[model samples]
Target: MTNKQLQVLKQQHALLAQFIIRLSLFYQGYSKAIDEELQTLRGHLGSNANFTLAHVSINKLNALLQEDGGVLRRFKTDTLQSVEGAAKALLATSGKANANTSIIDTISQARRPAESLYDVTQLCVQTITLYSQVTDTLPKPVGVAVKSHSNEPLQAPATLLMALQEELVQLLDTYQKRLPDNTELTILKQKVVEGLNNDELLNVCLTLLRLIVKDSMQEAIISGKVIQSLHHSLSSLHQGLNKSIDQAHCTFAVQQDDNLAMRKELIKLENDVARSDSFSALKTQTQQQLKQVGSALEKREENDRLAQQALSGQLEALKAQVAELESKTRYYRNRLAKQVATSQTDPLTKLPNRQAYNEHLRKLLDNRNINEQSLCLAVVDIDHFKSINDRFGHSAGDKTLQVIGKQLSKALDDNDFIARWGGEEFVLILPGLNAKSLKQKLERLRTRLTELPFKFKQDRLTITASFGGTCFSHGEDPDAVFERADSLLYQAKRAGRNCVVTDKDDV
Candidate 1:
C-alpha cells in the first residue's frame, strides 16, 4: 500500500477514535446527571415524607435511565459486531448514493447508541420542564406540606432545582452548538430531530426495519413486532413522563387547596377570637356595673338603717310625751277649777305669766304620783331683749320673741314640751329623755337661732339666748326642779349670756 493511502487510513481511524471518545464522554455526563438527579430525589424522599410524588417521579426516571442505559449498551455491542459488515459494504458500493444508503442502513439496523442517549436526554428535559411548570403554577406540595406540618417553609429546594434546570438547558444548548456540522454528524442530527417527531420518524423506522427483513428474505416473520417493542418502550417512557407530570400537578393542587383552607380557617379563628374578646369586654363591663349597683345598694341599706334608728327614737319620745301631757292636762284642769279665772297667758309669745308659772309648778309637785316620770326642765332667755326692744322698738322685740319661741319649739319634741314659762324665759319638761341628747338638741337650737336673721322694718337683726336646764329624777316636787333650773339660770346669767348650763353637770 502507498504511504499516502496508509496515512489517509490512519487519519480516518484517528477521527473514528475521537468520535467514539466524545460519544463516551457524552454518555458518561448523561449518566452522571441522571445519578445526581436520582440522588437528589432519594434524599428528598428520605428526608421528607410529603415528597411522595417526587419519589415516584424519581423512581420512574431511574427506571427510564436504566432502560436507556441497557439500550445504549446493546447498541454499542451491536455496532461493534456490525463494524466489519459496514466497512465491507462501504468498500463494495459502486456510487455515492449506494455508499450513503449502506451507511444509513448500518445505522438503522445496528441499534444506534445515540438514539437511547437522545431519548434519555429528552426525558430529562421533559421531566425538568414539567416540574418547573408545576412549581411555577403552584407551590411545591412537598415543601408546602413540610411547612404545614413543621411550620417552616422550605424554599431552597425549589430554588435550587430551578437553577439546576436552567444550567442543564444551557449545557444541552452549548453541547448542541459545539457539535461539528460534518455530513455524517448532520445526518445524525437530522435523525435525532426526526426521532423526536411523533409520526413521520416512526413510519420511517418501520419501513427501514421491513426493508432489512425483506432483503434478508425472512418469510412469514412478524416485522411489526420489533417496531411494536420500540413503540412499547417509547410509550412506557412517555407514560412515565406524563404520570410524573400529573403527579406533580396533583401535588401542587393539593398544596394550594390546603393553604387556602388553612388561611380560611385561620381567618375564621381570628374572627372568633375577636368576637370572644368583645364578649369578654362586655362581660367585664357588666361585672363592673353590677359591682357599682351592689355598692349603691349597700349605701342605701346603711342610710335606711340610720333613718330607722332616728324614727325609732322619735317614736319612743312621742309615746312618753303623750303620757306626760295627759297627766299635765289633768293637773292643769284641776288647778283651773280651783283658782279664780284670769286671762294671764301672753297672746304674742304664748308664755305663761309669772303667777301662772309659780302656781303650775306647785300643782305639779302636789299632784305628783310616786311612779310619775321625772322632769328635766330648761329655761332659755333671749339675751339683750330690752336693748332689742329699745333699738328696734316693740315690734322688733315682739318678732325677736316670736323667733326665739319658734326656735325653742323646734328644739323640743312632744316628750320635752316647752311653755314660755315667763317673759323671755321658756320652760321645758322631759318625760323620759336623758340630759345629753336633750342638751345637745337645745345647744343645736341655740346655734340655729343665733344663725337666724330677723327682719325689723328695713333692718336685719340676730339674737342669742342663754339656757339653764336641770333634771329632777328623784325629786317628788316640781318646785325642786324649778329651783334647781332657776339657780342654773342665775349662774348662766353670771357666767355668760348666749350659753347653756345645767345644774346637774357641765351639759
Candidate 2:
C-alpha cells in the first residue's frame, strides 16, 4: 500500500484495538467489583476465603494494568487469569474460616445493611483503581502494522525516492547552517546520503529503510534518556499546578466559612442595637470586625498571588532546563553516530569497510542458502597497486582507489553488491549467479575500467583489476569459501595480472 493507505489502515487497526481493550477493561472492572462486593458479603458469613481471593486477584490485575504495555490479545487472557487467581485465593483464604463453622454461623445471623453499604464503598474504590489502570495502559498497542505479500519487496517509487533524497539534502544543509560547529552529526548525515546515492539500494528501498532504522536506533537510546528527563520535568510542573489549585481551593473555602460566621455576628449585633438603642456602639463594633476580615482577605490574596508567581517562574525554569538537557543529549548522540560511522566505514574508499563486508557476506550467504539459490563471489585486486603508490605517491593511489570504487559500484547489477574487503582488495557478492557467468561479468567490468582513466597530477592513470571468481555452496563455511576465493586470487596474480581465475583454471 501507499503511505496514505498504510496510515489509514494503521489508524483503523489502532481504533479497533483501543475499543476492544476498553471493553475488556470495563468487563474486568465490573467483575472485580462484584467479586470484592461478594467478598464483603461473604465476610459477614464468616467466610474469609472469598474476600481474600478477590483481593489477590484484584491486586494482580492492578499490577498488570499498571505496567507500561501489553500485547492486545494477551489482555483478555490476563483478565481471565486474574479472575481464576482470585477464585483460588478466596478458596485458600477461607479454608481456615470454614473449619470454624459454628463461629461463622453466629456472625452470619447479625450481618447489617450498614456493613453492606461499606462493602459497596470498597467496591467503588476497586472500580476507581481499575479506571486508573485503564488510563495508564491507555493508547496501548500503539502500533498496528499491516503486512503485504509480494514476491518483490515493496519500494518507494523512483520519483518519491528522488524527492525524499533532495528533501534530506536540504534538511541536512539547514541543520549544518543552524549548527555550524556541530560536525559529527552533519558528517554522518552526509555519509548516509552518500551511501543512499547508489541506484541499487534506492531502487529497492529496503536497504535504505534498514539503514535509516539502524541510524535511528543508534540515537533512540539517548533520545529516550532525554525524554525521561522531560517526563520528570513535566511531573514537577504538574505538581506545581496541583499545589496552586489546592491553595486556591483552600483559600476559597476558608473565606466562605469566615463570611458565614461574620454574617451571623452582624445579625446578632443588629438585634442587640434594636433592643438596647446602642446603634453607635453596634456600628463601631461591626466596622471593627469588618475591617479585620478585610485585612485578612487582603493578606490571603497577596500571599496567593505571590505563590502563583513563584510557581510560574519555577515551571518556566524547569521547561528551559529540559530544553537545555535535550540539546546536550543531541550532542552526545551525534558523537555516538560519528563513532559508529568511523568504525563501520572504510575511511580510504568511503565504502563499507572490512567489518561491513563480513556482515554483508554472511547475510547474503544465509539468504541465498535459505532460498536454495546460487551465489557468486569475486575477489578483485588492483594490478600493481603498491607500484602506483610508490611511483606517484599515495595521493595518486588514493585517487585511483576512489575511481575504482565508484566504477565497481556503478558497474554491478541491481542485485549485486560490492564491499571494500581490505586495503587494495574488494569483494563482490552476486546472488542468483554461478562462477562461469561471474567470470564474464568481471571481465566486462575489467574492460570498462581500462576504458575510463582518472587524472592524477599531470598524468592520466589507467587501472586494471584481477578477478578470482567462485560459486557459493549452501551451508558452506564463509571463511573457508573466502579462503578458496583468496587462493584463486593468488592464482590469477601468478598466472598474470588483470585476468580472471576460477575452478576451471585450476587445471
Candidate 3:
C-alpha cells in the first residue's frame, strides 16, 4: 500500500469511529452491558492500536447494531409517541385554572435531558416548542386536565357506534353467504345495534381489523388455489401434447413400412410375370400380389383413423384445460382488484387513506398543468381530542372523528378532496381555490362541525377543529407546503382552537 492510501484508510477509520460514538450516545439507555461494550469499542478506535486489532472491536459493534437494530428503532418510536402524548396532554390543559405546575415541570425537565439519538432530537425539540406555544396561549396558570371518575353508563359515541353496527351487519351478511346456518355472528351483529361501552367498542375495533386481515388472507389462499389448479391443468396439457407428437411419429413410421411392403409386392409380381412360362402361373401370382396390396392399404387406413381420433380427443381435453385456467385467471384478477381497493381505503371513515393521498399527490405533481392550477392544502386537527377519549371513551372519540370527517367532506366542492390523515386529523386537497377562498371554505367547515349535535350518555357535546391551510406556490414541494400548512394549523391551535389560519398576506 502507498503512503497516501494508508492516510486515506486512517481517515475512513476516524469517520467510522465518529459514527460509532454517535450511536453510543443515541442508544444510551437501552442496556448497561451494551453501554460498556460501546465504551470499550470507542477506546479501541480512539487509540492508535493495530488496524487488525481494532477491526475485532469494529466487528463486535457491527454485530450488536445489526442484531438489535429493530429494538433500537422500536425504542425511538416509543419515545416519540411518549413525547407526542405528553405534548397533547399539556395542550389540552392549557388555559385551564386547575392545571398542575409540578406535573408540567416534571414533564419539561424529563424531556430536557439531551437526546442526541438520530431523529429523536427533533421530536424532543418539537415537544418543547409545543410546550412553549401552550404556555404562551394560557390565560392563567395551568392545572390538571383530568376530571374525577363518575358512575354513569359509558355509552359509545353515537356515530361511531352506528358505524360499527353497520360494519358488523355487513360482516354478518358476508358470513351468511358462506354458512347461512351459522347465527352466532348474526346475533352479535344485532346486539351491536342495541348499544356498547368503550371496552366493547375497543374489542369490536380489534375484531374488525382481525376479520379484515383474515378476509385478505382468504382471498390470497383462493388465488393460490386457482394458480395451483391452473398449473396442474397446464402440466396435463403439456404431457398430452408430448404424447400426441410421439403417436404421430409412430403412425408415420408404420405407414411408411406398409407402403414399402406394397411396393415390394408390385415389383415381385412384375418380375414374376416377366419370367412366367405360362399365363396360368402369371395369373395366380398376380392374384396373390393384389390381395397383399389391398390388405396393406386397409391396415394403413385403420392406423390413420385411430391416430386422428386419439389426437382429436387430446385436443378437446387441452381446450377444456385452457378454458378452466382462463376462468381461474379471471377470478384471481378480480380478487387482486378488490385487494388494491381495500389497501387504499381507511376502514374507520371509509375515506381514502394516507397511501391513497400519497399516490394522488404524486400524480398531481407529475402533471404538466399542476403549476397552472390553483391548489390549496390544509390540515385539520380536532381540538382536545384526547380529553374526549379520556372523559367519554375512545369509541366516542372515534365517532367524533367520523362525524367531523363526513361534515368536512360534505362541505367540499366537486373538485375538492379529503383523506383521513390518521388519528383525529384529516387533510384536504382543494383545487381552484385561492388563499381567501380557502380560508372561507375552512371556516365554513369549522362552523359546520360546531353545529353537530353530538351526545354521549345523554351529555350533549360541542366539537371543534383547528385548521391550517396554505396555497401552493409555483413548483413548491408538497412536503414543504404540508409543513407550512401544519404550522398554520398549530398557530390556529395557539390562537385558541376552533379557527382557521392560512398563509395569505391579507388574512
Leading candidate by TM-score: 3
RMSD of each: 63.6, 28.4, 13.4
Q: What TM value does model 2 have?
A: 0.41
lDDT of 2 at 161: 39
Please estimate how well model 1 matches the true structure, expressed as its whole-model Cα lDDT: 0.53
| The best candidate in terms of lDDT | 3
Over the stretch 9-31, how does candidate 1's per-residue lDDT look in tens digits? 87775565455335444545545
Q: Given candidate 1, what's the lDDT at residue 271?
A: 56
Which portions of model 2 miss their true places by more than 4 Å? 1-291, 358-377, 390-395, 413-417, 429-441, 454-462, 469-481, 501-507
Measured by TM-score, how close is model 3 to the native structure? 0.53
User: Where is model 2 poorest over a 10-residue stretch in terms of lDDT?
Assistant: 105-114
Q: Which runs of model 1 end up more than 4 angstroms from their true locations?
A: 1-344, 352-368
Candidate 2 lDDT over 152-203, as tens digits, reads 5444333333334433443343334434686654664555455454354344
**Which residue pairs collide, candidate 1?**
none
* Comparison by lDDT, 1 against 3, better one: 3
